[model samples]
Target: MDAMMMDAMSKDMMSMPGMESMDMDAMQACMDACSACEQACTVCSTQMMDCAPACMNCADMCNTMMRSMMRMQGMTPAAMMAMLDACIAMCQVCMDMCMAHADESPVCKMCAQACQACMDACMAMKATMATA
Candidate 1:
């Protein structure tokens, strides 16, 4: 992350009531991964591959997940959990679709990798929430 982003995230984190004690590093990492995945999925989806639907869905879910993190003040724990579930589902769909065409397109392979990483990050966030 850049200094400006870290600073902004720090300010946002400081304002959240109980979020001060949360793992800021993990959250930032997940957000970064989501942003990267969203970009890759968007570009890959434009290729008109069979994975287009899942890629579009993944892009949307990643945007939602990133925006929710950016605006944490609007989220309750239940809402956050629901979002995580949705993101994970989207990632699974995208990954499955991309994997099917991995042999035909390098973009699909890369997109699948991004989706897998995003799924892992979302799962980590979900685990953290469960412990909280």
Candidate 2:
């Protein structure tokens, strides 16, 4: 992300207790990672396999996560926790589905990895919130 965007995000994130300590670079990386994962999952879901449903779910959750971070003002601690749980649940489902076809399909393997990464990022964010 650009410096101006980082500055704007900092201005917005500073009001949140734990989030205030988050480095701009780390936040930007997480946002980019989520976006990439969402896109990968969406494209992979078009294959019409059992994994399609889980990929669809993961795509929705990742989009929600990105948007929630973008509009942090609307999020409370309780709401953040709930969203985190939902994201984790969706990621788990996606991972399970993708793993079933990972040996045969490169896309499924990549999708599973992306789901895992997104889950890790969400967990990191949730941990920060808990500490706050």
Candidate 3:
């Protein structure tokens, strides 16, 4: 789903000033990571653990980040960079919180891993934007 969306966005991106050379692969990876993180956090949030609130908040942020990436027409490079930073920060906090109970909760372990992956993907997107 995201691949098709990214493909369509690629055309729009080419016409946008300062985004003509944007890395579609990095964008796709970031979106995919956000989607995965959102799912993981949603499940983890149901675990009724200490990290539930953080997991729920992270899930919301990830969804917002993914949606913003999908609507490239509404995004400037600066705005996108800011969103990525916010996503990364949210994921970091969620990951730290989840990791605290990872040993006792499988859901938390999975959530933490997903958060780490999302953070990495967001960072990669930031680097791609920097080079572009």
RMSD of each: 1.9, 2.4, 1.7
The superposed Cα distance between candidate 3 and the true structure at residue 80, in angstroms, equals: 0.7
Question: Which stretches of candidate 3 lie above 4 Å from their native place?
Answer: 2-5, 8-10, 13-17
Candidate 3 C-alpha error for residue 78, in Å: 1.1
TM-score of each prediction: 0.90, 0.85, 0.92
Residues 4-28 of candidate 1 have per-residue lDDT tens digits of: 8777665655233454444566677
Instruction: Give the clashing pairs for model 3.
Output: none
lDDT of each: 0.84, 0.77, 0.88
Instruction: Select the stronger candidate by TM-score from 1 and 3.
Output: 3
lDDT of 2 by residue, 1-132 (tens): 456776765476644433454434545666666787799799889998889988998898888877776666667667767987898789889988998889999999999999888888878877766665
Q: List the residue pairs that clash in candidate 2.
A: none
Error at 65, model 1, angstroms: 0.5
Model 1 TM-score, all chains together: 0.90
| Top candidate, metric TM-score | 3
Superposed model 1: Cα runs more than 4 Å off: 10-20
